[model samples]
Target: MSEKWDKESILSLSGAFQTCRILLTAAELDLFTILSDGPKSVEDIARDKSWDERGLRIVMDALAATGFLQKSAEGSYSADETMLKLMAKNGSQSILPLVLHRNRMWESWSKLTEIVKTGSNPNPLGMASRTSEEVQDFIDAMHVVGSVMANRIVESLDLAPFKRMLDVGGASGTYIMAFLRKAPHMKATLFDFPRVVEMGRNRLTQHGFIDRVEIVAGDYTKDELPSGHDLVLLSAIIHSNSRDVNRMLYGKIFRSLDPGGTVLIRDYVLDESRTNPPDGAIFAVNMLCATSAGDSYTLKEIREDLETSGFVSVNLIRNGANMDQLISAEKPR
Candidate 1:
């Protein structure tokens, strides 16, 4: 046997899976937060958290060996500096919920073989056999995912001239809150299903943006969309459904906007050739497993959709994180 193992060696797949599960389980258990204050021995840490000492010790040692923690000479363990950033509840830093949500996503992905064989979404849509709460939970999960980028999106957008921005399908008001923090002069109407609106309202209230954010409760597809906003922000939403619905939504956005208004969309966009962007390629399969018609679209595909819906000029900006692209279209005056 070779003393040094190849990083890309096929034999390491099993170890990689175990490593990911341990990291995810630690994040889900708030272990990072618990360790943020100071270092602790395995027994004390386990006793404090009511965890199994032996199991926690094994996990901690594995993480330390993997460089996520440091084992001291005194036999206590401390979180690595990079891992501490993920423990923050506020600021632009929370990765705990995002990591936990992904762990849940892994369950659906484990049945990918079944999904491919049947060509059916492993995740149930709100339509059949699923309760309203189940649907809301799915939406809330997306909300958590979206929150990760809310801070960046809010700061990046030029909201100086815009008075009221409408966040279509904006779950939990995370985007609006981030924007409100920057553009305090602007108010936002968060439009979504009634259940989502309730969740957003609760979040807005908690974030102290209740006065600046208005909740508009209704189905955006069937009902009349809230009108007269200078800007419409649809982050991580357009790629969630069929091409037809995406085009239809763009048309509605154009109509809902005042003349020369802007519509901003952020999501994983495939390259113009419909290749190269590996994240978009993988995200396409995730949509296959999750939604009835959702798949990540290419930049060319999205630009065409915007033009067909009446936007004269469309611009695409590729942000380096997670292969996400932000496209902006302006309603012709």
Candidate 2:
């Protein structure tokens, strides 16, 4: 059912972007991080950063009004204690990198109208174009989000029969670590681009699970995956590819797996209509804005693609509102 909209609600909807923009702008500016040490006057902040006082004051005021920060009668703004912790750059639990990445996404999302009109991103920003800092932030963003669900998702799966596993496009080995934690005896391979492979090595080494995993560095889209695994994971990977690319990748996964081995996909598995889950519909737009040729896929599309690539017994293992949805299939024995 559609939302019951009246004039007030419609206007409210129209102004939704304003609040998000304010938050994103503040996050991008590192305003929270700046305030994390202590409250500061707008003049103090602007002078320290060589930014315009007027612009800094306005954003801080908006943040204070929105309860993200507090403004005292003395005309200084301070970040909330809890909020500051999560936005602090060096804080272990900080999600600042993810927030900053979304701040970058604002540029792409700003061109949604143009993308819709031209049926293409006017300025497609590919992964290889990212600077070292941006690449680290992107990998950190993926890890921050993946770490939350990886353990839970791994726990739900039956890992008994699977002796060896491969994590395709596994950034920093978040899911691989989780899987290994669940079943320590299983041998594993963590595959990704070379830079990301190094990050995964550090993470696994830090966690003391390095010896159990074999790290392989290669682009799944451009190279064959490492073989001899009884299970494979493609978490949040498929939505970035077009159907044709996913089909070819599925074929690679099928070959990489031992006969009757399982390949589990964790992504936004949309229904036939592709609109049942509102977030999936919205993320479809996000993919369009971010990727050169990416959009959320319906399960039917996924099943057909997998089948064409020689996967069988496709099943919707779990339905998730966000990007946590699961689809499982196998290479025939």
Candidate 3:
């Protein structure tokens, strides 16, 4: 069901990218952090940062116009206290990493028109193709987004029966750390690409779980999984693969699990019509812009794929309005 739309609303929707683009520009420049240090004239900022004065001034003014910054009486610009706290690099509540990742995503989305015409993302960009620094930014961004939801999702499950956990594609080990914190006696194995595993090892060491986690580095799509785990987690991972790849992955996961072990997949599981909770429908476009055949999967599609890999008792275990929907299945005993 579509919301009733008006001409004004339609026009408003068409130009929504203006504010987004302006915000992305400001965030990319680390303007929020600089302004938080102290308000400065555009000349001071541009000269210090070696940026184009004209371009910097225009974006700063646009940020003020968007109510994300304030212009002082002395002709200096600064972020509002609240906005600074959220966007500044060193602020107590900073979400800057996530913003940076979105800037990278903006680059990908810019090719949407060409992708639609070619049926492929001609100049695709993703974590698999990023520099070392950019890879850290992407991992940190995912942690910032998942830190709260991870605990909530873990709290919903009764994990007492599962002693070992395998967190597949676990970026930064955020969910694995959450699981360990919840079940102190449970040891985990985190699997991801080599670069991510190195960072994960560092974080787990800092959090004092380095001894409890066995970190494995390999690509899940074309590699064998480590076996004998009783619980597995695939959080926010499946949407990045085509169905055939997902099936191949599920089969690998199935073979890796202990008998009667449970596998939980947390993602934007769609309704039968493949469009509900609205955001999932829209996120399918994001996948299209990044992957050749990746997409948001309806529960029927997910269940069928899992079943084809020999999973049983598959069902939607949780549902939400955003990307927190979850599905669970078991390797029959």
Candidate 4:
């Protein structure tokens, strides 16, 4: 049965995109830090940012309405607690990069009609004619998006006893470092394209997981995986290809996994019936725009695939927001 309408849903459904734009514009302007020091009048903020006072006031008012800032009757503003913790630069996972990338993404999405009609992705990776710089920018955007999910992903899974963990298609090692922090005994082999491995290595080290994590630079499609890892992980990685490719990769993973080892697969998973969970469904649209044969999979499909690959038992755990449910399957332990 359908649920009753609520004020929250009614407002969010209508104003969500506008709210996102308000937040993104603020992030782009570094408005949080500007206000972080203390309350700032609109005139002062506009002066510092070289923005129009009238426009700034309107924008700030929206932010206040969205709870990112608190506005006083005197027309001054201060950062809210949520903004300081998640929006400000000094926070644990500063969402700045992701916000900026969204700015670029909106531009590309204007061509969604073209992509749909021609069945071609307008993204840099999908655009064969895109310049080298454009490709780098696209990959960089992916990195920023990956960073947003890294911390929680690592914390959600346990890694204490595993000595070696292989991260297949590990983009920036954000997921690896998350795991490494908890499982101090774990050493990681981060496998991905050569350039991505290099870039992610620096990022992982920047987060202080470098000493134990080994970056493996290779195309996962053609390269040989290092054997003897206690655990293998794919974080937000496998949803990029078709079921045939996924099956091939799982087979490879089974062959490479040591006896009694585990394979942990994390991505946007659809529920058993293969519907609802709006985030995963929307992400499938992104996959359509970017990947040739990629789409989100159902948990049932994942479990069946794992079992076919020799995993004894499978467990699924769901995390909130960007870090959705994933499955852990054992290799006949």
lDDT of 1 by residue, 1-333 (tens): 124656667678656798898888787677778788889899898887788998999998998888888999998988866788864333146566567657766776787888889988756443234466555555556666666567766667677888989999887887888888889899999998876788889888987999988899887678767898989988878767789999889888888999988998888877666554777777878777667788888778888999999997788854644745688889989
Evaluate residue 37 in candidate 4 and report its C-alpha lDDT on the 0 to 100 scale. 73
Which candidate comes out best when scored by TM-score? Answer: 3
lDDT of each: 0.78, 0.88, 0.91, 0.75
* Candidate 3 per-residue lDDT over residues 1-333, each given as its tens digit: 767899999999999999999998888888989988788999999899899998888988888888988988887998778988899999888899999989988888888898889897875555677899899988989989999999998898888999999999998899999999999889999999998999999999999998999999999878999997999999999999989999999999999999999999999988888878689988999998877788999999999999999999999988897788889999999
| lDDT score, candidate 2 | 0.88
Task: Give the lDDT ranking, best first.
Answer: 3, 2, 1, 4
Off by over 4 Å in 2: none
TM match of model 3 to true structure: 0.97
lDDT of 1: 0.78
Better structure of 2 and 3 per lDDT:
3
TM-score result, candidate 4: 0.72
After superposition, which runs of candidate 3 have C-alpha atoms over 4 Å from their true positions? none
Position 131, candidate 2: lDDT: 85
Whole-model alpha-carbon lDDT for candidate 4: 0.75
Question: Cα deviation in Å at residue 193, candidate 3?
Answer: 0.5
Where is the poorest 10-residue window by lDDT in model 2? Answer: 120-129
Superposed model 1: Cα runs more than 4 Å off: 1-14, 33-57, 69-93, 124-157, 181-184, 206-208, 317-324
